[model samples]
Target chain A: MRNVKLTVAYDGTNYHGFQEQRGTGLATVQEVLELCLGRLAGRRVQVTGAGRTDAGVHALGQVVNFDAAGWPIPVERIPLAMNGLLPGDVVVTEAREVGQDFHARFSARAKIYRYTIWNNRIPSPFNRLYSSFWPVPLNDEAMSQACDHLLGRHDFKCFQASGATVKTTVRTLYRAEVIREGTLVHFVFKGDGFLYNMVRIMTGTLLQVGMGKASPDSIRNLLESRQRAQAGPTMPPQGLCLEHVEY
Target chain B: MRNVKLTVAYDGTNYHGFQEQRGTGLATVQEVLELCLGRLAGRRVQVTGAGRTDAGVHALGQVVNFDAAGWPIPVERIPLAMNGLLPGDVVVTEAREVGQDFHARFSARAKIYRYTIWNNRIPSPFNRLYSSFWPVPLNDEAMSQACDHLLGRHDFKCFQASGATVKTTVRTLYRAEVIREGTLVHFVFKGDGFLYNMVRIMTGTLLQVGMGKASPDSIRNLLESRQRAQAGPTMPPQGLCLEHVEY
Candidate 1:
């Protein structure tokens, strides 16, 4: 069997995250890839992705992997075939053969996610569905200062969603910064791993700090508490995106 | 009376067009804006846009002007108020007081429109609704050369829709350029005016040239013919957008 790695991009507006559920709903990226691959390889093939973004979340650099029996098709031709089979919203940007043991999720050294907020008093028509529109003024400096406390390894239970089934709540954050360009504010995070809705909760906490609803010190205390109730409300899924993954 | 200028944006996926129509096949952006404005002004207010875009076409910098009979609301508050009433797809990006002479259409000096094509083999999920996805390989150089032939004033009757009721077929094109950034090709046009379906037709012709189905010189001959039958196929409206208007 040969392992193939794919760099993918998707508009997550209509998806139920990246995984396949048993019941009928909108199709997920994983299911679409598996079906296409199965057809191409003439057998059942399962595809796994680096991360699963929630509904309405987008991605630019999502990674996926699958093993296939020896096929006559060239590696470069796989994307072309997938394009013909898959729907428009999920695309393989790049694909290549990888080491036999390469794992799309486990081999990743770092992952980056970006959250966008339209900060103008008026929301934009084109961006209305893709970005979060918040009319209130935000203080980027305060938000960045609060984010500094989040860098390094920490038990992020407070920022995690309640349904996360992982044994350990510990995650290492490489960088967390909030920056503004024009009327848009971007929250960028580089991390070893993220819990369910962790980035969304962190964004909400940072937004509160930026809006002066919470103080910077609150993040430190919130992290220490390890209680989901201590963190700010989870931001909506539409504004978030899986930006990149490094393997 | 006060004149208000609005910079509007919208996702055209669900709209009939920018102008209101007789029946409710799909909502027009004008209908949404008028309804929202009527609520904010507490009186009937009609909005006049820079121009009309076809059904399923989007906009980033569509301008509009409206006259109101009461004390004008603060420009800063207009976006918030309009957003509260407008649907999720339509957004008022900017609202400011303008001279009574500031007409959205007639006073415009130039207008910019962009057509996006996803050139990669696989269609992108994030850009699926926003761009046209074609699996065919496009020669960007050939498309750019073809666009160069369309950069001046000409009779655009061949590029127009057959049922259009416009009085004149002559229009000056300030710029018609095809630019490629990575796998996406952007067809940008700056013009004094456009015939109905002119941009889409131009896109279709250029796409044919890029695919080597037609020569770059063919565009010049087609424009000179002034017969709609000589032009290329009319492209889908979903890939087109009113990018901006300069006054």
Candidate 2:
């Protein structure tokens, strides 16, 4: 049985999330993908996604995998076939045949996420759905300087939201950057793996540093404290995007 | 009565157009703005827009003016007030008190429009509502050369769609250029004015050249013929955006 891997992209505005909540009737990216893939396979197929993104969190390069033992369709044409059957909000960008043992989540080395912010007094209507609106001006320099604290290996428990039962709270963060173009601010993160709502909380903490409410050094103190309540609030899902999944 | 000018931005997905059709009950940017402005004035008011964008056509810097005599609210704070009352899809980005004789349409010297195209085999879900999908390789160099034929004063009757009642079809095209960044191709136009669907038709004609189905010189031939049928099909409205208005 050959495993088929798919690179997916989706606008999460109308979806509950990437994870399917069976019997709950909440629309999700995984449910729609499985439905389309199942039809192609002629049997119910189980699809596994690389990330469990929340509602309103967009993705540019989400990854998924499923066994295609019964599906005789060429792997190259899978993208076209899935796109034809899938809704407009979700699409398969690329498809390939992989080893049977390959796992979409476990085989991933790192993931990249981007958080977009509209930094302006008046919000942009065109960007409202895709970006978070910050009415006050932000100090991008200060924000970038604060991102340094998140680099390298660290216990990111303070940045994580509640309800996650994980083996460890430590993680290796390879890169974190704040890039600004005109009125739009992009906070980019690349890490081995992120905890639940970790990127959002880090972004919120950086925003506080940008606003001068918290000093850049405060991030180091927050890390030492490892207290969830001490960290900044989690940013909205609309501003967060799963940018890439590296295997 | 004081004349107030507004720089507006809208998503345009839910709007019929920029112009108000009194009896049609079709929701439009003009109609919504007037409703919100009337409430502020505590009386009826007429609004004049610089451009009448079509359905699904976005605007980044649409200009509008209204007589706000009874509205004694501070002009500097008008944007905040109007944005509060307006829907999430529409917003007043900037507001100012202008000269009494200043007209949003008549006083405009030039307008800039941008048509965005996702030039790739797989359409981006995030860009679906904002850009046109072209699932083929486009020769951007050829398309850019074709844009040169559209520059300078010309009777754009061939590129115009029917149903426009303008006094003349001759308009000065200040700039026409095709810019590409990754999988996104942007067609930018700066002109004294445009005929009905002129930019869209021009873009479609250029696309044909980019696809090698036609030559760049055909744009000159189409202009000389002055026959709408000889040009090209009008591009979808969602790909078009009014970027700016210069007075």
Candidate 3:
């Protein structure tokens, strides 16, 4: 059996999420990709993505893998063929053959995400779909100071959404920084793994520091508290993007 | 009587064009501005714009003028008030009382237009609405060489689209250049005025030169010929943007 890995890019504005729901009838990136892959493979095909991004979250370098044992088409040509069948919002950018044991999700070592905020009095029409508009002024220094508390290993229970249940609340954050480019403020995070809505909650908390609602050094207490209510509100999904997956 | 000049910005994706159609029932930028101005003035209002951009063309600094003889609101407060009534796609960025004799169109010394081309194999989800995607390898040198021939005054009837009647086909191009930034190729043109579909056609011809379909110096012959049939096809309007209007 040949394992085929695909690098995908998609505008998730019209999608429910990355995962395939059984009977929701709502469009999703996974289902659309599986449908196209099935057509190319001449059989039912299941795709395993590196991460399940929330609805309205975009991705520039999402990774996925599928078994193409019986497929007649070469792995190199898969991207071109599948792009023809996929919707305009989703595109298969690169495809390659991998080891039989290679897995899309389990084999990932790290993932980088970027959250964009348009900090302007008036929202720009060009960035409406991709960025979250925040009219208030943001203190970049305060936000950066808050980001310093998030680096390295930590119990991120306070930043995680309440509904999800996981075996452990611990995760390793490799890098966390806030960068400002013109009117756009980018919050970039690279981690071993992220809990449900962890990045969004962290972003909201950092923004609160920028807004003077919270102290920059308060993140240490929030993380130690392990209470979801102690963290800031969850930011919206539209501003989040899966930037890259490092194997 | 007061002549109020306003700086406008709009994402023209949803509108038919900047000019209002008599009976087409199509929404336009002018009509929307007039509707809001009329509401603020408590009477019918007409707006004259510096440039009548085509459908799907964006603008960042489009200038417009309207007489506000009996308007109750002060000119400085017009933008805030009009913005409340304007749609999300259109925005009145700045409003001020101008000289009575100042006209939006006739008093303009030059206009700057920018055309963006995504010259890469993989399309960018963020720039899809703002740029034209062309996967083929473009020779930037050839395109720049072609731009050299289009500088200064010339009878550009070949670059002008048919069905537009004007007193003279000669127009002065103050600046014409092609710049490459990473995967994006930007064509910037500053001119006294552009004929209908003139910029789009010129872009198409330059792209043809880049593609090796036409020679770099062929633009001189195309201009001297004054035959629209000899020019390249008109590019789509979505890639065109009215960057600024200079007085």
Candidate 4:
């Protein structure tokens, strides 16, 4: 059998999420990819994604893999062929053959997530779907100072969403930074692994610091407490984007 | 009686157009604005727009004027109050009281229209709703030369859509230029007035010249012929945006 790896991008506005739910009758990114791949392979094909993003979360470089033994189309042409059958919101950007043992979810070394905020009194019409609108002035210097506490390895239990069943709450954060471009603030995080809603919770907490509601030093106590209640509220899913995954 | 002028912005993907039709049941930007104004005024109100954008055409600084006599809300607070009732896609960026003689359509000195082309092989998920995707390579020099021929006053009958009745087809062209920004090509036009579908049709002809299908000198003949069939096909409405209306 030939293993095929694909890099996908999607708008994620009309989708339920990345994972497929059998009994819910809801559409998902994985289900759409599987449907298109099965059509091209002339049989049922199951695909696995690198990350299971929440509903309304967009992606620029989501990775997925599937096995096809007797597929007629060449590996390089799979992206074009799959894009023809998929919806306009979802597109396969690149496709190639990979080793059989390279699992999409297990072979990932790091993931990059980006959260966008429109920091202006009047919200932008073009950025309505892709960014969260914050109508208050933010101190970028304070937000940057808060990012220093989130760097390196730590127990991120305070940032994890409740009811998530992760085996461990400890993860290594390779980088954390806040960038401001015009009236837009971008919170970027690169980590070895992330728990459910970790990036969104972290963004909310940093925003609180930027707005002067919390001090940058408070992050240290929150991380040490290891309690979900100590962290800020979870930001909306529309502002979050899975930017890339490195293997 | 107070004459209120509003500078509006909207993502026109879900709207039918800027003008309100009597028999058609489709929702329009004008209809929505009037609905909110009437609710705030406790009486029926009508608004006149500077330009009548086609279906799926966006706007950044569309100007509109309405009469508000005996209105309860202050003129400066109208934008904030109306925004609370309008949908997320449409917003009134600025509102001010104007003279009674100031008509949004009649007193306009010039209008600026912008057409965006995604000049790349791969379509972007973020720009799907705003730009028209063109995969082929275009010669920017040829498009610039074509724009030069369209700078002066001329009869634009060839650029007008069929069945559009206007008092005169002769109009003054203040400026026309094509600018390339990264993977996007912007066609900006400023004129005293534009005929029906003039901007879109002119953009189509310029794209033809850039693609080597036509020569830069052909525009002169196309204008002199005064025939709609001699011009290139009208481009789609999604790429056209009413950028500004100058008094």
Q: In order, what DockQ does each candidate have? A: 0.68, 0.80, 0.49, 0.70
Steric clash pairs (candidate 2):
none
For model 3, the stretches where C-alpha displacement exceeds 4 angstroms are B38-44, B69-74, B80-85
**lDDT of model 1 at residue A206?**
93
* Tens digit of per-residue lDDT, candidate 3, span A1-247: 7899999999998999999999999999999999998888889999999999999999999999998987899888888798778887898889989998889999999999999999987767677778898889999999999999999999999998998899999999999999999999999999999999998999999999999999999999999999999999999999999999999
Can you rank all candidates by DockQ, best first? 2, 4, 1, 3
Every candidate's chain B TM-score: 0.96, 0.97, 0.96, 0.98
lDDT by residue for model 4 over B1-247, one digit each (tens)? 6898999999999999999987899999999999998988899999999999988999999999998988888888988899889999999999989999999999999999999999987777778789898888999999999999999899999999999999999998999999999999999999999999999999999999999999999999999999999998899999999999999
Candidate order (TM-score): 4, 2, 3, 1
Measured against the true chain A, the candidates' chain A TM-scores are: 0.95, 0.98, 0.98, 0.98
Taking the tens digit of each residue's C-alpha lDDT, what string does model 3 give over B62-172? Answer: 999999997788888887788778887798878888998999999999999999899988777667778898889999999999999999999999988998999999999
User: If the candidates were sorted by their lDDT against the true structure, best first, what order would they fall in?
Assistant: 4, 2, 3, 1
Q: List the residue pairs that clash in candidate 3.
A: none
Q: What's the CA error at residue B70 for candidate 2, in Å?
A: 3.0
For TM-score, the strongest prediction is 4
Worst 10 residues of 4 chain B by lDDT: B120-129
Which residue ranges in model 4 land beyond 4 Å of their true spot? none
RMSD of each: 3.2, 1.7, 2.0, 1.2
Better of 1 and 4 by TM-score: 4
